[model samples]
Target: MTKFNKTLLAAAVALASTQTFAAGFQLNSQSATGLGRAMAGDAIIADNASVLARNPAAMALFDEKALSIGATYADVNVEVTDAQFLGQDLGSIDNAAEGKFIPNAYYINPVNEQFAFGFAAFSNFGTGADLTPLTEVEGTISPVDLLGNTEVATINLNASMSYRINDALSLGLGIDLIQGSGKLSRGSLVEVEADGWAVGGIVGLAYEINENHRLGLSYRISPEMQASGDIMYLGTEFEDINIPLADIAQLAGYHQLTEKFAIHYTAQWSQWSSFDSITLENPSSPEQILKDYHWKDSWFLSLGATYDINDRWTVRAGIASDKGVVDEQSSLSIPDSDRIWYSAGFSYNFSEKSSIDFGYTLVVGEKVHVEEKNAILLPIDAYTESGANYFSIQYNYTF
Candidate 1:
């Protein structure tokens, strides 16, 4: 491949991996109730049908049919500042991240004394950013390989079943149908588009120590996604690409301390170390390594509390720490960093069978210095800061 072609190909790889909204492009906006408490104890809360998104075993806690629908608006803010190449100012980009809305729905039904089933629709990962405007800097050479528009989205449709074994233990299994799509462009130098589907699953266990204490654990198995579309490299087109996704494991606990108060916590892990690289393949040539992430595993920890104000009102608050996944290898397209979450929300009981929930959270990311190589293998330096505000609402009903 020519030097110019190699440069643009590297740029495409960086764009393909860019995900700035959440750590490594993983999303946590499944439900408003979970968001309010930073997802603490979400796997075992069993307060509503939304629990199906986490642990299906929690369905055993309900004796009646339940439904929940909700949506979250993520207002993301990302700024790339003081970008330079060998002392030459390449300018900066303000608000490169885009805003989006995430939606979810869930339903649960108890079939008999020992069986329950549920369905859920939600997103586990997504990202969107536009840095194309930075390529228009005047009186200076633009870093064409480092600036572009990128958008990626994934949705998970789940069907789960739970079996109650005695009164203290429950086991659950779920099947996931994941849909993914992406688009990347760099001012005509390169444009890649793809869409595909994959299958995965999750298993969970719920243990009830007493009427006021419970614990839940779950592990999600992710698939290697294979997508086909227009993938151009050095004027040659490849028919397919394979992207590896990370698995997830989490443990959660809930303790009702008093008649009107409760405490909950969660420890979650993302197996990002398995997401080592991206590969491009075609019938005419051998598989080629498009990019190597060299990312590390990450953890997210959260603690929360709920308080009852009255028969019709309840309030909750939470805090969380999210560790970054980027390791020795970094990219300007991915400004990954450690983050903190502060959240609050409330539920209003309209009656015994219906209610509404509202939650808000502020995510703050640490500013970090990033170093990357340009087309000619020259070092480029930049500073990046990312943050977001999440507002969510949901309607829930029980029958």
Candidate 2:
């Protein structure tokens, strides 16, 4: 390999070393309309094949074949200011990252009244961050221009069984065969390395109350997802960082208020705390150990509604607040914070079995105060990160 490519590869490996080497973090995406409506009741909507990824029980609602394919574009604008290296101006920096296209697909099939199966691919988690021109260049700054990003992806094969317990209740159970991967990169001046694996499974359940109301839940067993890669800085091999992936939980429901309107809500919890820290195995003296992730558990709460405007048009809208897992000790890469969401969407029915769905979301990040001490030219603070914008479209078909 050429020197540039080798350097880039080392850089990539180093980048992956810093990120949680799971499948990459997921995009919190399920459906276009779900995005427009803040993902409320995504587990119970049972509107498309993607429902298999949320709550396996929702598959029971599909008595025929169904498929959903779509993507979301994310526009991220970040601003970092108040630079002070011993109280120097350092000049403020404002820039935006290239927008990302988040895409996913799902398919579901039903047999008789007691069984269903589906497959789905979606971003389970991921985050990206880049900082241009530090206060001081070279020796004065350990990291001159910081550019780092982490990605996680998952493909799940699922099977579900639904039983009609009675005239008023139906129950469902499901299993997920999950595959995941991760990639990392830093400092455009260097190469990027990516490594990760797919591992995770568990159970899911759902319940329907009458013909118009439903609830669903899902859980993934904690998996020791393995991330293996090489990290190189300035042409020197750094070390390898390995992380154990955490578990997930989801609960959601749908309630029809009238023939024309319905309301829904979702509550989800992630065991991020399980990621206490990562241990890097290296041969250097002292082994270059890093400590203190101290990540906390987080939650997401959302409320949304679907309105039938007419025979050909349906509308979705929602708002949500999702807590951050990062604490006061977040890294420079992903200056992550809690977020609030406002979203809206529409679905156009081309026919009873074919339709198009579109969604738009505005995310507002919470303002935060950060301070860096010790060696290196980090900073005493960075700006409150800006929220992101998401636009998505999906083509859905059922047979």
Highest TM-score scorer: 1
After superposing candidate 2 on the true structure, give the runs of residues whose Cα lies further than 4 Å from its correct spot.
Answer: 1-26, 135-192, 233-240, 282-288, 328-331, 374-380
* lDDT score, candidate 2: 0.64
All models: lDDT?
0.83, 0.64
Judge candidate 1 at residue 160 and give its lDDT: 99
lDDT of 2 by residue, 81-126 (tens): 6644555544445643446677788888887676677777765554
Would you estimate the TM-scores of all the predictions? 0.95, 0.83
Instruction: Give residue 221's error in model 2 in angstroms.
Output: 3.3
In TM-score terms, candidate 2 sits at 0.83
Please provide, for model 1 over 90-125, each residue's C-alpha lDDT reduced to its tens digit, 9 standing for 90 to 100: 787788878889999999999998999999999887
lDDT of 2 at 349: 96
Clashes (backbone N, CA, C under 3 Å), per candidate, total 0, 22
* Regions of candidate 1 where Cα sits further than 4 Å from its true position: 1-13, 16-19
- lDDT agreement of model 1 with the native: 0.83
Q: What's the C-alpha lDDT at position 356 in model 1?
A: 96
* Per-model RMSD to reference: 4.1, 5.3
